[model samples]
Target: MRAAVVISPLASAVLAGCVVSQTQGGAEHLAAPDGAVYEGVDTRLLDGELVNFVVAMRGARGPDDVTAYAECAAAQYALIRGYGFARQVRTTVDEKNGAWTGDAVYTISPALPRGTRTIDAEVVVAACRENGIPTV
Candidate 1:
């Protein structure tokens, strides 16, 4: 009976590990080509010439986990930009295991260009002291 119990738990653990491995693998495949993952941003007109934007980050393990790391990076980016811009925004982050995620909503004035206005935004997540910003 004791052996059976041990074997049962071991089997369960192995199954769990397999599930996690599969999930992680799938996430890696879905990861952005540049290795920089990005979630869709929902944009709304808060006022004339003003817009409210919601950015979300998702990953494997769990959407919440992916969000957590993303939020931290986002906050740092916002702070580097300026408080004026950061204050006009709200952020949410979630994480699970090795996965990370983040979400934010904010308002911007003066409006951007008609098309997509890509700004230079990058964050350092490790201590390797390497830059991940892509040159446009």
Candidate 2:
């Protein structure tokens, strides 16, 4: 069974100054909770199985939303490449006056990382789908 991803009230609460998250491509495109438009996930393949992912939500989205969106994107992207697992190398999340973004670098592999906050790609993809987040 796959775990479900739930958006917390605090994460979903968007003020007039903030844009809300919305569906796109069968999933959310990093939309702002306040209904402001934002960028979708951008997955950049790097050397030796590494990937750089960027997800942007407009209108001062929350940090949790940023992380959730990024994770969902990573899982989908990994599956798209026929991978079974992924490990986060680093992540930088920022929320400014009108934007919340998650910039992450990860390594995809057939097995999970020995340590650290590694993630199982298929499991995550399933979770995302269960939560209505689109997978690649």
Best by lDDT: 2
For candidate 2, the TM-score is 0.66
Q: Highest TM-score: give the candidate number.
A: 2
lDDT of 2 by residue, 1-136 (tens): 8444333221232222233444421123333245545478888888878999898876534565566667767777877888877766777888777677889888887765554445677666655554444443
Supply the global lDDT for candidate 2. Answer: 0.61
Question: Any runs in candidate 1 off by more than 4 Å, and if so which?
Answer: 1-34, 58-87, 96-101, 111-136
Q: List where candidate 2 sits over 4 angstroms from the true fold.
A: 1-38, 59-61
Please give the lDDT score at residue 37 for candidate 1. Answer: 51
Residue 15 error for model 2, in Å? 33
lDDT (C-alpha) at residue 106 in model 1? 37
Candidate 1 C-alpha lDDT tens digits along 1-136 = 3221111111222334431212321111212224445554454545542434444443344443333233334333433444212222444555555334445443322222222211112221221012221110
In terms of lDDT, the poorest run of 10 residues in model 1 is 127-136
